[model samples]
Target: MIYYLFQWLDDFGVPGARLMDYITFRSGCALVLSLFIAVIFGRKIIDRLQMMQVGEIIRDLGLEGQMKKTGTPTMGGVIIIIAILVPCLLVGNIGNVYMALMLIATLWLGVLGGLDDYIKVHRHDKDGLKGKFKIVGQIGLGLMVGLTMVFSPDIVMRENVEMRNVENSEVVIEYVQEDVKTPQTTIPFVKNNNFDYSWLTSWMGRGATAGGWILFVLVVIFVVTATSNGANLTDGLDGLATGTSAIIGTALAIMAYLGANIIYSSYLNIMYIPGSEELVVYMAAFIGALVGFLWYNAYPAQVFMGDTGSLTIGGIIAVFAILIRKELLLPILCAIFFVEDLSVIIQVAYFKITKKRYGEGRRVFKMTPLHHHFQKQGGIVTALIQKPMQAIPESKIVTRFWIVGIMLAVITFVTLKIR
Candidate 1:
């Protein structure tokens, strides 16, 4: 709203109104405004949740201080959602396709997660929404994002072509004259970062392009579902998911800015995604919201994000990466979420196989969701790799995970130069 107002004022020759024309300026403003909203309004929301008895239902997991968090307010993700949406609406160019997609993703996941949390808290069903139902919701969101990308004419990219300056002995890259829609994405450690999904359907010949899009849509569905669930699972410890998401959001913001800029896209030899710079403003708000939420979400958490925040955060990251053609980098950039997700899968599969073979259930980790595994004391469960005899402090664990997340973000950015 403020953005449009500034635009109108700029038309009338207002001196400072033109500042909104710069992505950096608008993004900065969005960041500050989001932070202000989250911090200032967060306490009141938390108070309301407390008054309504919207506390978490904790099962005794036997980890240190586990029971202490039982009554902490849950579903505090509403604060984050409001903070993020308000700033974006005020400062973001909502007309941009990428911005519109991001806003859709936020609301879609927010509602889905809010429903899940509502069931768990209000209905007193610890299982919350049925697993199948959650999966269905995720699939529905994936389809929405995937189909939009396929059909939206505004979403297009220019392929960067490299040329040799024979006389000057320098290499130069140039963007094509026309923007083309393709299922190409950035892949790390390759001289040419472009990886076209069409390559998988080359046997189709004339129909290969269409087949590639179908495959791309499937990939989008899978990525969105997996990452969103990964985040939900990683929300085991205070600030673990929130801090890591903020880091990931920062990296995505940088990627969006560079991909949208013609000069940077050419220099980096990456796809030039026209009009993607608007995503920087959206992401700036995202980062601010998470950080502000962290004010209460950190150690000795005052409020829990529940599914409301985790699912939305993951969906945002996935969609943002897809928009900037950087989804291929998520495995590395989002390694923490992936590892947390994989730990649960491994533990479950190992337990099932062992039980079938030995007639008794065995385990891999003391608990699932890797973060909780570190918080468990050694020798308590039959598991592999239990060398850490003492449980690590929750605060320490979150900090270490955050450090790892930071390292991953840095490495992700370096890949642009390495390629």
Candidate 2:
């Protein structure tokens, strides 16, 4: 690991060894290194996948440009996984609990996804691994993350309590006291952004605080499942998941930086998470990896990420937000993914409900997953609610969604200062 080597070199009077001391410098280095790895090695990985005949099994969706993607390589998520792990191992503090947790999450979900992809490609099952197994894996991951946060000594938060009064009955809150492990997370746009799960367990009386861990674990499970599924649904088009994930990663990087800085955390009246700054280094690597992978993934994708990248991306985002105590912001930051997930649920539920009453199945959108709905041909006789006058090109749809993701990222950060 470069970090330890440089750290030891400092004792030997090695010049510029101090660069590792700065989070900014280390993060920048991580970005560059990861980007280089993703782009340079992406081609080789794609070739290997091609040699192995690991290609995507495209289902007929009848959308424009759909067949063109037939036989394109899938499971390119290896590129991202390698890019992130290498940089973090070389430049990051491996001993930091947060870093360790992130590494585990990345690899854990990545392996699960890789397994699913393997089943699909080798076993010739388009359905891949059973749905129950995937849920079990996600639940397992959530359990690990939840229990780790509850029990880890290094995991803790600084509470922000109101300190002074301001105009219009507003009070400026200031964070105080030593960091202690708690089930508290930031809730945006509220005066005191901190929300503790123990409050929900007030019925426990004097022991309510202890019961908060139980409540928090449930919330972690829900967050992990929802966000990961949301991301998985969003990986439908070229550059859609990769580009949107890069945006989310960038916003998360800012949150990690601010949450770890005592001055910024106190000034913003947010919980201070010690050692979370290391997450910035990881996020930079994540962003770089996604962007570099996009070089080959955008428009007519040369390779697909399959569940390998999609599931890992989602899991990483969920875990990173949890570590920074900003999991509550996920709905706002990952709104696009949420909408995509919701569209399918809504459409399916509506169709089933209507079919029971009308003796025939109905539809909600031209197609589900939200993205395909936009690409569907505008026809008067279609089974669903069709609002768009005409079909949009796939490229335009992806770009527009990206623009929305960018907007959400900005607004997510803005909400912190808005209060």
Candidate 3:
């Protein structure tokens, strides 16, 4: 909104209106505005939730201070959603295809998550939304995003092509003059690493392109579902999910900025995604929202984000990466969320197998979700690798995880050039 006004004024030779032409300026404004909104208005939202009796339901998991978090005002994710939306709408290129998809993804997942939070808090349903319904919603969003990438003429990329010097066998990278539409993504640690989903279906001959897109859509569905659930599982500790998401969002913002610039992208030997620069403005708001939400979400929390924030945050990260063709790099950038996810999977699978064979269920970690495992004292549950004799402090665990997240972000950037 404000962006267009300044853009129009610039065309009329208005002084200083051209500042909006710089993505950095707009992104900085968005960051400050979103932070102000979240910090200043977030308390009122928390108070309103308390007035509505939207308290969280905490189960006793036998960890330190487990019961103290009970009755914390839940559904505070509305604060984050609002903070992100307002700033992006005002400062971002509202007409850009990438920005449009980001806003859509934010609102779409926000609603889905809000409904689940409503069920859990208002209706007092421990189950919240059904698993099938949640998966369906994720699948619906994945299809929308994937199909848009296939059909939208504006969503195109100039892939970096590699040239090898015969004299010295040295490799040089160059960009194509024309943009191309394809389901190609970058793979780390490999030369000429543009991996295409269509290659898997190139055997289809006449229908190869269509088959490739279908495969990409399936990948989208899986990525959205897995990432969202990973976030949901990681939300157990105060500020864990929120802080980790901020780190990931910051890395993504840097990636979006570089990928959107032709010169920077060419120098880095990566894809040049025209118009993805708009995503930098959107991600600025995203990082701001998460950081602001952290103010109240830190240790000894005043509020909980519940399903609303976690699902929406995860969806935004997944869709943003997909839009910028960096979805393949999520394994490194989003390692924390996936690690938390894998902990639960390992615990459950091991317990079931042991119970069936030995007539007694065995444990892997003292509790599922890797963070909780660290916070728990070792127990005699026939578990494996319970070496932490004493429980660690919540705040320290969160800080250490954040440091790891930063290292992973650095690794994610390095992977582009390491290839």
Candidate 4:
């Protein structure tokens, strides 16, 4: 809204209105405005949730201070959704395909998460929407994003390189061609960062292009489902999901900037995605909304994000990575979420296997989700790799995880330069 107004004013020779032409400037303004909205409206939203009794249903897992969090307001992701949408609508280019996709992703997952949270709260079922239902919703979103990227003429990239005509010893840096379809993505620790999906389908010979798109869609579905589930698992502690997501958002913002800029794209030897610069504005709002929500979401929380916030955050992170052609980097950047998810899987599988073998159920961790494992009861517990048997404080655990998230963010960036 404000962006269009300023853009029109700039055409009319209005002084300083041209500042809107710069992505950095608009992104900065979006950051500030989103922060203002989150801080200003957050309290009121919390109050409204309380009035509606949209409280978290806690199960006693024997972790320290676990019961205290019961009834804390959940589904606070609405705050983040509003903050992001408002800023993007005001400052982002409404016509940009990337912006359109991001907005759809934010709202789509938000509604799914909101429905899950609603079921948990009103139906008094801790297991909100059925697992199959959640998976279906994630698959739906992934398909939408994949089809859009494939079919939308606006969503295209140009491969850039410094071409050398060896006969004359002349070199020129240029984009290969106009926007066209390809399954190219960035791979860390490689001289040529761009990796094409068609290479994986080389067996298809002349039909490799079709096979590559199929593989790409499958990859998108997996990423969206896995990341969203990982985030939901990481929401075990106060401020854990919100804080970690903010860090990831900041990293994605930098990636989007580099991927969208022709000069940087050429320098980095990556795909140049025209109009993707608009994503920087979206990411700026994401970071701001998470930080501002943290004002009340910090330790000794005033509200919880519930599935609404957690799923939405994960979806945004996943889609952002996909858009920037950095989906491969997610394993490193989102290691914490993966660890949390894996811990539960390992624990559950171990328990079931042991029970089948010994005719008695055995445990792997005192609790699952990895974080809660650190917040367990002190006792003899049969588990693998239980060196740190001593219980750790929740606040300390959250802080340490945050530090890890930061370290991962740094390494994620450094990997691009490392190769």
Candidate 5:
């Protein structure tokens, strides 16, 4: 609302209002406003949650300092959600298609996650909302995002292609003159990094474009599901998900800025997405929200974000990447989340396989989710190199994981040129 008001004032010759015309300025305001909101208002929300008795139900997992977290306020994700939404509403271009998509995603997933957290706390269901319903919500958002990206006229991209300058006889990277809608994304370690989704359906000849879009929708669903689940699993430690998410959000903000700017896109030899600058504003809010939340979420935590924060942040990351055509790079940028996801799958699958073959279930990691494996004191009999035989302090584990997350973020950025 404030953005539109300022934008209109700029047309009326208002001096300071014109500053909103610059994305960088608006994004900075959004960051400061969101951080301020989360830090200042976050305590009140946590207090309200405590009054409501929305405390976490700690399951005794035998990890270091595990049970001590009981009775701490959960559902603190509401602070993050409010922080992001308020800043975006005030400082972002609400009419931009990219902005609209992000806001809808924030609300949609926020509600879904809020319900799950509500169930866990109020209803005393550790399982929370049913898995099927959660998946349905995620898939619905995926379909909505996929359809909007395909049909929205404002959502378009100019392809980067190499051209020879006739006068100089030199090859240079340049974007095509006109923007087009397509299921194309950036891939790493290739001479020309663009990979068109239609290639997956090239066998269909003239129908390839349509088929490719269908495939893209399915891919969106898969990415949303996997990323959300990964983040959910990674929420095991204090400040783990919050700090790591802030790091990834920072990297994403950079990408969104570069892709939306024609000059930067050309210089980087990457696709130019015309309307994606709004995503930078959104990501700034995301980072601010996380960092401020981390104030309470750090070790000896004052509050837990519960499912509400985990699922929403994960979905946001996935959608932001999709909008900027960087979904393929998620494996590298979001390696920590996915690794946590894989640890559980590996542990469960291996246990089942061993039980079937040898009449006794065996383990891979001492505990699932990978992070807990570090906090756990014992090693699985079948596991390899269990030298960290004693529990590592929770704070040390979180700090090290954050360092790894930073390394992944750097690698993700380098891919813009490494390709």
Candidate 6:
């Protein structure tokens, strides 16, 4: 709202109001405002949650410090959601299609996560919402995002093609004649970072374009669902998900800025997505919210984000990458989430296979979700990889994982230059 007010004031020749015209200025303001809101109001929200008995239902997992976290206020994700939405509404350009899509994605996933947390807390169902229901919600969001990217007239991108100036012995990159809608995304370690989905369906000849869109939609659904689930699983530790998300958000903000700027896009030889600069404002808010949440959510956590924060954070990162045509970079950028996700899958699959063949469920890690495996003391649970007999401290484990996440973020950024 403040953004629109400033726009009106600028129309009336107000000197300072014109500052809002710069994306950097607006994004900076949004960041500070969101951080202020989250840090100032977070404690009060945690108090209210404790008063309402909205505590986590902890299962008896034998990991160190597991029981101690029981009854910590969950659903503190509401704080992050508020922090993000308020700043974006006040400072973001709501008319931009990118901004609209982000807002929609935030609310859609926020509500879905809120419902899951509600069931776990209020309804006393540890299982929370049924797996199928969560999948349905994720699918619904993926479908909406995919369709919007395809159908929204404002969501076109200007492809940057390289050229050589023979007379001057210089090389240059230029955008196509006009912005056109295409299912092209940035792929790392390639001569041309842009990879168009349409090429996969070239065998269809005239129908290849439609087939490409269908393929894109499926990819969207898969990415949204997988990343959301990965984040949910990674939320097992204090500040793990929140801190890692903030790091990823920072990288994404840079990517959005580059993709949206014609000069940077040309220099980097990446797709020029007009109007995507608005996403920088949104991401600024996102980073601020997570950092603020971390104030209470860090070691000896005062509050837990539950599914509410984790799912929304993951969804936001996924959609933002897709919007900027950098979804292909997620595997590297979100390496922590992916590794945590893969750990569980491998552990579960191995356990089931061993049980079926040998009549006893053998283990891979001492526990699933990788992080907990580090927290678990060896020999207590039968697992294959048990070199570290002593359990690592939770805080230390979290810090190490964060270090890994930071390294991954650096690698993700380097890919652009390396390519």
Residue clash pairs of candidate 4: none
Write down the lDDT that model 5 would get: 0.92
Q: Which stretches of candidate 3 lie over 4 Å from their true place?
A: 164-171
Q: Write the per-residue lDDT of candidate 4 for residues 192-234, one digit (tens) a residue.
A: 6778888999999998988888898889999999999999999
**Candidate 5 per-residue lDDT over residues 264-350, each given as its tens digit:** 888888899998999999999999999999999999899999989999999999999999999999999999999999999988999
Per-residue lDDT tens digits for candidate 6, residues 21-128, read 899999999999889999999989999999999999999987777898889999999999999999999999999999999999999999999999999999999999
Least lDDT summed over 10 consecutive residues: which range in candidate 2? 380-389
Better of 2 and 3 by TM-score: 3
Question: Each model's C-alpha lDDT?
Answer: 0.92, 0.91, 0.92, 0.90, 0.92, 0.92
State in Å the error of residue 240, model 3.
Answer: 0.5
- What range of 10 consecutive residues in model 5 has the weakest lDDT sum? 378-387
Q: Which stretches of candidate 1 lie over 4 Å from their true place?
A: none
Per-model TM-score versus the true fold: 0.99, 0.97, 0.97, 0.96, 0.98, 0.98
Expressed as tens digits, the lDDT of each residue in 1-419 for candidate 3 is: 99999989998999999999999999999999999999999999999999989999999988899899999999889999999999998988989999999999999999999999999887889999999999999999999999999999999999898788999998877899999998988778877778889899989998888999899889988888899889989998889999999999999999999999988987788888998999999999999999999999999889999999999999999999999988899999999999999999999999999999999999988888999989998765587968687899999998999999999999998888886
- As a whole number from 0 to 100, the lDDT of residue 347 in candidate 4 is 81
**In model 3, which residue pairs have backbone atoms overlapping below 3 Å?**
none
TM-score-best of 3 and 4: 3
Q: Give the per-residue lDDT digits (tens) of candidate 1, residues 188-236.
A: 9889779999999999999998999999999999999999999999999
Model 1 residue 5 CA deviation (Å) reads 1.2
lDDT of 6 at 222: 89
**After superposition, which runs of candidate 6 have C-alpha atoms over 4 Å from their true positions?**
none
Q: What is the lDDT of residue 306 in candidate 1?
A: 96
Candidate 4: stretches off by over 4 Å: 162-174
At residue 63, what lDDT does model 5 achieve?
Answer: 78
The collision pairs in model 1 are none
